[model samples]
Target: MQTRTYNHVDYLWDDTKAASLENDEVALFLYRSNILGSDLRITNYGGGNTSCKTIEKDPLSNKEVEVMWVKGSGGDIGTLTRQGIAGLYTERLRNLKNVYRGLEHEDEMVGLFNHCLFDLDSKAPSIDTPLHGLLPFKHIDHLHPDALIAIAATKNSKKITREIWGDTMGWVPWQRPGFDLGLQLEKCLKENPGIRGIVLESHGLFTWGDSSYECYLNSLEVIEIASEYIEGHVKKNGKVFGGQKLESLPSGKRIEQAAKLAPILRGLCSSENNMIGHFTDEERVLEFINSNDLEKLAPLGTSCPDHFLRTKIKPLVLSLDKEESLDNFNATVQILQPQFEDYRNDYKEYYEGCKHSNSPAVRDPNPVVIIYPGVGMFTFAKNKQTARVASEFYINAINVMRGAEAISTYVALPRQEAFDIEYWLLEEAKLQRMPKEKPLSRKIAIITGAAGGIGKAIAEKLVAEGANVVMTDVNQEALKETTKSMGKDEAIQTICDVTNTTSIEKMFDLSCLNFGGVDVVIHSAGLAISKPLEETTMTDWQLLQDVLVKGQFLLAQFGSDIMKKQGLGGNMVNIASKNGLVAGPNNVGYGTAKAAQLHMTRLLAAELGADKIRVNTVNPDGVIVGSKIWEGEWAEGRAKAYGVSVDELPSHYAKRNLLNEIILPEDVANAVFSLVAILDKSTGNTINVDGGMANAFVR
Candidate 1:
């Protein structure tokens, strides 16, 4: 079991460079903490904490004082800066051990921790600061690593730890993290002076050392030993797969049942005010879900107490037969909704069992993770960031469970302990103190022709405003590049041939699976034909109609269906053209098609208003500023029709407008978003971005 063979890399210390003279302890502490937090296997977004105790000169009295700087509340160690770690007077914090009334509630510990900050410039320290402060060492590292959680969550974890490492590590059974827990840790350390660290049963790992390197190595070495033990156990016992045999497709891919079931799962987690982000599609995740014992194995509890804050104690399990899901959401809701309600009711009863009359009121009873047979596992949360975090921890929890179960059985903390962590004030602060969401935050949007120009511009604006945008275009290569530029976390890309029903349906399905549902649609996809009516071929006219006219019809109808089904009522803005109101010479096809779309906007508004859905049009003129539409032959034809050089055409159009402004695609994009974001009660109306095209004005 003592397999400390993995080489631990010290990424922060540079041999060639001179170390900074100021505050070396705090500097080196952040350096090593960042290295530890950088690896997801060691820690995730906000799952771990690190601390360093040193003597610093107090700015007020200019006197030397013992100080402890730990990762602050809500700070991610991976990106920790000097400001991210709070500097607390170590002696002052320890003094609270006597004055503090063994553990009462109401976020008072958080307040007291805030009061102990050595400097006003420091942020609030973590709740576990007490535990870190009580340890007698220069550096202390606490990591909820997967390997550590694997061994610690086992039934005989304490006995196992004793057998493998002797007294180098002490074991503390589940004690809810607080002042009392800190006192318990102190007592354990005193009783076992030879221990290098302590593994909190059903919790996480703790290690300390006189130097930063010693602490880092101590943690890595001990964790590897535990990892080897589990690895050895797993190699002998083999692995456990869901006992159930999953159906496979002809192509050998597991039957993907997520698209059909996602909407119902999402609706089950929905509330009048919640916008749930749905997550799925990882290979390991899918395989785990396909396992036969999934229903039995998954509900045990969180692998670590900290994980309970996000995933809750257990998830809502959904089972399905192929027949029930064949009809998708329309049929699936009838089966899944009642089960979701039961899950919520059970959670309420579970919370009531621990209701101290002082616990934080129960949050929306919806489970964050929903596990299904064919669909695997999906995470639900109010925003993309939080949902992804939950999914990250949930995936790690599964690995921990598998590792533990491979050795013995995955035993979790008691229900009351799990409830304590879930309701702990520090964790509750994360939920209560969340920053105000953006106007379009948690909303999902779709943009057609999003590869470039106005469609792309609109997508960027909506994404900037906090909507998770799905960008679709006929150009697959361009769509990939577009997705990369927008940051993959919030952008989903797919090819959409708007005129084709199959392609359009696939685009909406992708949106539904990725973000749970769609709340806004901007129909900016279109094509144009510059030839005069006499010069236009029948095929030329038809191709323009297919992309411009038929595309809008499909988008409006399809987008409306999703919104109506969601019953949340959303916004749709059709990017009609100024040519629709005032036809331009040699632009017959483009203008006629755009005109039809403008009319369709009114029709959708009239029809969808009963559901509170709003539909409108943004009529943009001279929005050809940065478009590729002015390239090659298309550019030549447009300039020829205007009797101007290709380079001068934009200037010519600008002069023709009353404001003499060259309208960029972004200008039109702004106009389009204005309709969806600001025009809450106003629809069936057209806002023009034509820079005052007098003749283009509608009566």
Candidate 2:
């Protein structure tokens, strides 16, 4: 590996920095990780730690003191949440280095430490708590950055470090990285007296400062310099292989197979009964299946250790031959059984060898990695997000392994050590301490025509309220572009023609597979046939019914099926026209179809009541910006029919309302969200979001 150099100032002062920090703490954590993770600088999965120290006045001592909010064990920085930061007693952590034989049964000592502390939760402190506690600064960050790791992994790591950081930085050789590593760091700090940071050989880097921002910036700066130096010097002239050409699978068959396979895979993974929708993307499955070099390259693990908890250590690689594929999958599992057994035995041996009275053994060494020849990967996570994280890690790991293979050979961590880390009792305890209820965290939603107008507003609103929204529209480009601005993890986009049974089934199936099950369905996809009754042909009537009436029926039917099976009463909001409730002169087909839709909503609500599926409708009057009915040729026709210009039509409609204000998509979305979130008792109801248009009495 060679070294490259770049200016840290470029990234540090970028405008997005402040915004990334100011958002939810979790978002900030992930954003910082993305910057550093992409650069391979400070942390990789479970290897590094970060903390923000806040000053609190000690009531007894009547003096200002500090508590370090540090990254908890068992959480990945790539997807760290606010709860992942464990608050620790800083004073006690700094004191641990002075004690003799600090290495022996440190897990027991942690309990004692926690007992002595104040305001700390029952969660287990991170193994790096002592390191965090000892830092004099208000903020501290540490990571096993890949650039530094590559250098540390080399034979001349010490020499390389001396050349780069010189006497001001301390260097520690690799040690089993919990309590012992903390003690080693303390000793290094003592010897160096006033060093800025420490670089652990075959591990990572550490940096701290007076504030959280300062510490984060310093770590980024150092890592940037390290990365730049490596890239500049490293002769990465090896062939850069292009991604595999995906063999085209029949889209319809592929989707059907994916839908069929999702539940089985979800059950096998032991996911919560409601979360099957998260794994159901046919496109994603196809992408995984078509990726090149599955047989030779699929078993490599994640870039970081914690990813193993989600994605497992290996994928189930399926073969082209059906019998051979099943045989290979079974054989792989059989081979893995011994490895798992041996891992558990060794973990027990390690725990027994230590023999700490306070230390408890963790969960068993179940196989984290599985392989099948022809089928793509299946990540087993307790929830949908974690599963997705695991999938991404696996994909990245495969790429890394292929790259490593091109350069040299792929070497994984020893099984015993891997098991020790994976089953660390302290780590498991940290996970248990996380809040049990996330309110609406895992709820699944489907928002039709979400590329624009009311659909987009509703989708955005649901997403903000913690629902994972699957957005769809017939305008594929628009759908993709619309969701591009939204966060990728919680939102997905698909091209859907709701009138078509195949499309509706595929969409519903995809939603269930990816998210577990559906909780809410907001249908905003509809067409308006504005021609006179005499001019409205049978074809026009059918088209209107297909999009407006049939679409709602199919969506409600599928949604009810999944919701009933999950036993969680679901909410369905149909977007009907105010014209449907009142007679309109020229909108014969549209009005008639929407009226049927309104009646259908009531009928479905009655039918699905036994299944705990609630159906309702939102009737909005007149034009809203971005609605197809409001834009294009339809608006002009409506304006002409009403004897007004296109611009005056909004006011004409608003004047008929009680509020005398034009209705917005957000207005309608707000009503829908309120209904879905709160109005469980009232189903088979139509809520008019027309700013009092129902009072017009112009019939």
Give the number of the best model, judged by lDDT.
1
- lDDT tens digits by residue: candidate 1, 1-699: 222457422233343331552348788888778878887777778888999988889988899999998998889988999888899999888888767765565246667887788867786787788889988888999998887887888898998888779988999987777777787889999999979999988788899888776777787877778777877877787666534457423222223356555655666677535565666656667667767767777778686866777788787777665334345456666777788778888999989998776689987888899876555567888787788888888887887887778776788778887887788666776777877888788788999989888888898899888889999988888778777767666888888999899999888888877787788888888766688789888898888788877888888788877776666888889888887888678888777888888898899889989998899999887777666556566667778888999888888889999999999998987877777777688989899898998887877
Summarize candidate 2's per-residue lDDT along 56-129 as a digit string, tens digits: 67767888887666666565665565666676557766666555356557666566556435455523566667
Quality of model 2 by C-alpha lDDT: 0.63
- Per-candidate TM equals 0.91, 0.61
**What range of 10 consecutive residues in model 2 has the weakest lDDT sum?**
318-327
Score each candidate by Cα lDDT. 0.79, 0.63
Question: In candidate 2, residue 603 scores what lDDT?
Answer: 91
- Cα RMSDs, all models: 3.3, 9.1
User: What's the number of clashes in each of the models?
Assistant: 4, 39
Residue 506 deviation, candidate 1, in Å?
3.5
